[model samples]
Target: MGKLGKRTVAAREAFAGKENLTVEEAVSLIKASANAKFDETLEIAMNLGVDPRHADQMVRGVVGLPNGTGKDVRVAVFARGPKADEATAAGADVVGAEDLMEIVQGGKIDFDRCIATPDMMPVVGRLGKVLGPRNLMPNPKVGTVTMDVAEAVKAAKGGEVQFKVEKAGVIHAGIGKISFDDKKLVENVRAFVNAVSKARPSGSKGAYLKKISLSSTMGPGVSINVDNAVAE
Candidate 1:
């Protein structure tokens, strides 16, 4: 295809054969494909009739993607002491409980995520109405609720990265941006996979990491096969 023709072409290509593509091919495909797109995603279909549900359990931690999830994470860091000052200095959209409630009531601050020091947790409880239904309230399962102000602030400004086993038992997540180099995206994905695989609940049955896939912002998700995700 000519340059313009290829440019207009959909980037999606099926993962053919049992053989895995080289790193070069993988990265080139992700970067070149302009057809990438996203939908409100859900569980990964790993196999026929084997919809897995233990993905959330294998979560390592939710990280703030430095540039956001290609979108802004209206972070509300809850704190009211020395930690409060710390959070503000770190560039958090800092809020004390009183201010937090007012913001919520005004419907002005639609926070994408909430990070709080242990000191702020008690007060955060008061705003359950404002945060819970939206899934904006951070949970310990993903390490958003913490005593460390520095970590909280950093993670808050960071992207809201979550890991979970989709129905296919495949771990799915958005690692980084399409503008990011393939190696970096691969690295990010690799790191995430490692963390999640390590955190696999001991209670889980059978082998973990049924498969893997990587895609871009507006393109179809092309899979990264997992012959042995644990091995690497």
Candidate 2:
């Protein structure tokens, strides 16, 4: 491995021996250690007890962070007629039907979130192979597949975050930015934890939330006490 940079070394030293911290403590530590040139995103990772291989064991949901994610979210909408105009007015970065699919198929997906009206699913469905792997497929469960194009567009550009457990039973997402106030970060963390807690599948056995960690884009991660994280 290459020599560790000064910032990374310092961050690791500060995080040494820290574990099972409260949400606030973890957020503070992560924020303090985020010294990258650009504003670093505050990320959260949760390890759950259930494997996602089984349909019933899957944990997937969306949460709107109390404090919007610091990054600008580019939204692409699949709609037509008035709904298309609504999406554009609400700030969608891209909007279309077959034309959008062709663009996506041509490997030109430039947006972060994708929204589709219910009637546009057929067109969106054809891009499943292209969008599903990236977790960009518009799903009704998360309200991305809906008739309310305007609300969906606004939410996407806002702070809405969608999370799905990986095969190894881990869910990861950016909760906010290190520059956010500690209180806002904590609130975002709690809101996310609560959403995941509520999304616990019936098939989950023993402990639903096995572990949780908070980290910045270029900083070392700190473990958070699962109970404290969910305690509101």
Candidate 3:
């Protein structure tokens, strides 16, 4: 491995010997050690006990962070007529039908979130190979595929976050930015954890939430006490 930078080294040293910390403590440590050029995103990772390969064990859900994700979210919507206009008026960065599909297919996916009205699915469906891999497909389960385009667009721009357990049985997402107040970060962390806890799959056995951790874009991670994280 290459030599560690000063910032990385200090962050690692600061997190040394820390484990199973309360949500508040974990957020504080992560925020303090986030000494990067830009405002680093505060991220959370939960190790779930479900094997997603099994349909019954899959875990997926969305949560709107109380403090909002510090990053601005660009939204794309697939709709026509009033729904299309509603999405645009609701601050969607891009809205369209086949025109939007052509843009996405042309390798110009510039949006962070995507929403689609039911009627537009046939057009959006063709881009499954393009959007599915990036987890940007509008799925009904997550409320991205709905007739309520305005609300969906608003939510996407207002800190809504979707999370699905990966093959490794881990759910990861950015909760906020290190620059946010400690209290806001704490609230976002708990809200995210609770959402995941509620999304536990039926086939999940043993301890559903195995572990939780908090970290910054350029900092070392700190494990959080599962009970403390899950506590309301």
Q: Estimate each model's TM-score.
A: 0.71, 0.98, 0.98
- The clash number for model 3 is 0
Q: Model 2: per-residue lDDT, tens digit, 1-232?
A: 9999998899999999999999988988888889899999999999999989999999999999888898899999999999999999999999999999999999999999999999999999999999999999999999999999899888877899999999999999998988889999999999999999999999999999999999998888999998898897
**Global lDDT of each model?**
0.56, 0.93, 0.93
Model 3 is weakest, by summed lDDT over 10 consecutive residues, at 27-36
Model 2 residue 17 lDDT? 98
| Model 1 local distance difference test score | 0.56
| Model 3, runs deviating above 4 Å | none
Model 2 TM: 0.98
Candidate 1 off by > 4 Å: 1-9, 12-24, 35-60, 63-73, 158-160, 164-171, 227-232
| Runs of candidate 2 exceeding 4 Å displacement | none
lDDT of 1 at 173: 59
- Tens digits of per-residue lDDT for model 1 on 82-110? 87777778777656666776676677655
